[model samples]
Target: MTENATGGEVTFADMRLRPELLDVLSALGYEEPTPIQKEAIPPLTEGRDLLGQAATGTGKTAAFALPVLERLTPQGDGAGPVALVLVPTRELAIQVSEAFHRYGRILGARVLPMYGGAPFGRQLQAIKRGVDVVVATPGRALDHIGRGTLDLEGLRTVVLDEADEMLDMGFADDIEAILAATPATRQTVLFSATLPPRIDGIARRHLSDPVRIEMGHTAGEGRETTPLVEQSAYLVARAHKPAALGRLLDIEAPTAAIIFCRTRDEVDQLTETMNGRGHRAEALHGGMEQEQRDRVMSRLRAGTADLLIATDVAARGLDIEQLTHVVNYNVPSAPESYVHRIGRVGRAGREGVALTLVEPREHRMLKAIERVTRQRIPVERLPTVADLQARRMELTRAALEECLLQDDLESFHAVVESLTDEFDLMEVALAAVKLAHESSGATPDEEEIPEVAPRAVDKRRGPRESAHDGERYQRGPGGGMTRLFFSVGRSAGIRPQDLVGAIAGESSLSGRDIGAIEIADRFSLVEVPQAAADEVIAALRQATIKGRRPTVRRERDTRGRRPR
Candidate 1:
């Protein structure tokens, strides 16, 4: 292993990777190993179980991927797959699979990324032909296992990437089942951004004699670590978030930005709204096909698209070099999630901005995140119409300056000279500037977003608590919650996670926003925010639950009348 005399910097060459992998790393311009990578590769290459805690953009992918490639067996050994990597989302599965392919190019590694929403026949054929590595989502991995298409007896290594995210997506049971199918002697490695108690329980149960490593934002920086991200929030009412976001984007004028939303519907809605406002915006969510997603990403990377409005799951594992801003459309459900979202930007020593739109009710949630992250996120006033006009004038002035310096204006000098003869020189210049400003597609925002103050609450009461009490009558953070009835329940093998995932996947309500759920023998009742009740009902009516469309409706009283 090669290291500098100071013993602080270690090159990828020092990691003892094979010649092929080293050459690929060099070609990719990777000089040294990240903190997580440096500490993990050694133990992992030695076949020891590992539990690593590092946030996004910390190079954890290379840490696990390089080791997996280093230990790959030769092809045509009749071994289905020597390595199995389970991720939370299909995007991450594809990303990790591509990394393995890139690093293992010289080894002729047969790597496959298996996930839902792709052609099943192709994945099945790939497995039948034989693969050295399989990177897959937990649910799809379980599907193949049940179909007898994926055999784990020959597996030598099992990696759970983004382990906490999988659990949050209701894949814990599926992960446990897949792990149970793998060989007990196989090397197990789990990586998560946070070490919650549930994560610890999984580590205790799955990893044996593991090497534990924990490093977050301050990894290798010690107490002097400083975040490069400028975090701020805007206190706008729920109804004005779209306008506020549009105004903020106009003033900020970022090179590129990723706006995170909670659900697929929200992503689509915001994408359309932003596009109408003259921004080249794109939507990415679970509903999009693989091909469509590839097109969106290509457009963004090629500089044709400026805004990527995406759901949390679909946007996982994406790192864009030119990203300058990260906007939270709503307060994140969890504080750890806030950390992960902001981590996407402010990387590689580049300054980045993190902006958020906070509704009155979500102020408390935002405060909780601040307390957890130990960072103060000052709420800023939304930009007014006057601010927008000034920003547009500035942009027009800069554009005109660039044109005068670079463009061939000699051709238009004759027209200007002729006009100057009939008009004052200053008047002609003002006319020219006005035409330039108008042609630049600068539309002034008229209405001002109403500002809302945070609700003052008694010290004893919670922010979300309503006047009513009892588990049966609980409300969401916003207001009262309404219970909806589904025809299928325990008999159809329905679980809470299944319902949570279904609602969260289809509607604007997140899993955290959902209230108590009761599953009976033949029916189920789930509580959603009262304001979102109709939307949830409409979405569920259109979606299938457990492969069957269940009759959905607002629960009624014993008299068969709707509850008031």
Candidate 2:
């Protein structure tokens, strides 16, 4: 197995793939095959059943997709797919389908993705018309087959991507059932990050004389020793995470990134928080519809959305072109999950960064991942205000230089000439630069996010004692919900949904975490679960109610009601 220099140069020609695929690869600027691509493509192209162990971002999609495209002869007026790629999640099914479409444009391969959330009618129609490839989640694929909407009789290749995850999600029966329907002579391939006995059992049962390829194939560099994922972890308190994440993003300044959160609520909340901080971020989770998911992906691919905050399941199989960073909002529950999250970056000779926020209590989880991966995730401190200032200055300087290069001075000469008569040229230039800097979106007035205890606290505590409004009653007599008072109310045209959306977006809390809402003409009272009151307040500090900043604080009671 050959590894190009760490992110080195090579060509699809070296792999001796089909000439049509080579042309498409060249057009896509795929100058070299990734480790998995280089290794797996050869045997796969020869129509061999194979088992591959590779993580995401290892170019596994291309590894399998390219060979499938190559072996496919022109369809002879057939309505059934020649190849099938089965993934564990709907997001993955769509991503894999897109990859096939991308790589096989020259071959005129008709690729379709079928999954549960989407309208069944569309998938049914596509299959009826005809398709070259079908990428589907196991359950949805089985559902179609049962309804006689999808036919697998003519399948030439069947790929089980993330085979272990499918089994873990309880799709083993569906997979077995699907395979049973496909011809026994069909080529069977399986790719996974790790091989449990379950995966081994599937390979043994399904594959015939399969070729095995492992992913950590490194060439001349010592990259195998360090690994290219640039893994790191941060020890952060739960309360400070929102502010801390903002500060770190300012320093890192990723081209595009995926921030992994554990739950749909966290994904939505972080998505909102990032947007509030002047970031273009999209949220993806199970709660979102197929249409919403499509729009989020479209925005991300169009480069209009830079940050994608998603839960693990929602992010499965995504392969974005300019993604440079992967941030885990919290350490994942399992080492395999950590592996999967970071696998989204460090693809195809790209230098990628993987950052994880580790609560003190979750430090063990991080270390466990380290033990499994056999690489230490360095703990990084949050960037300071001075550091952010330096980054901003660098950005401002870069922006100014770029504009100077691209903009013609002929038109702007009049303004500079007019200002030069009153002020020195140097002073005038500095003033113009100040205006550009002001519009650059860097907040020089950003205060530092306070540090919390070195170790994580078991129970939520106020980050600081409330210094404004009524006395805080966070932990009520019954220890359930605490009422918060916002200075803006019905007069400001704020509704419960607005408050709920804002709270869910800005803070770590979800809509369900909030209890009751009482709105008056000039003021409002809302009950939030006791534990998250401080976090909600922290998130709101950087937010606006009715496009204006308002006082949001813990209320002593909801008794006071007054009209505007």
lDDT of each: 0.78, 0.74
Q: Show pairs that collide, candidate 2.
A: none
Candidate 2 per-residue lDDT over residues 1-564, each given as its tens digit: 354456544457766778898777755545356667777888988899999877554568898998888888886238999998988666567678888988888788999997655667787788778998999876667767877888887899999997755654446667888999999889999997667798899999999999998654322222233366897777777788988888888889999999987656677788899999999999998667899999999999899998999877678889997999999888765465677778778777778999988765455455546656777788876788999988888988998898889977789899889989999999998988788888988788887776533221112222232333332322223347777788887667665545654564355553345666666777777788778888778767745554556788888545655321
Deviation in Å, model 1, residue 401 alpha carbon: 15
407 Cα displacement, candidate 2 (Å): 36
| lDDT for each residue of candidate 1 in 342-457, tens digit (9 for 90 to 100) | 88898888889999888754665576566567788999878888989999999999999999999799999999999999999999999999999999888853687776665322
Off by over 4 Å in 2: 1-10, 217-373, 378-564
Cα TM-score per model? 0.57, 0.49
Residue 275, model 2: Cα distance from true site in angstroms:
21
RMSD for all candidates, in order, please.
12.4, 18.1
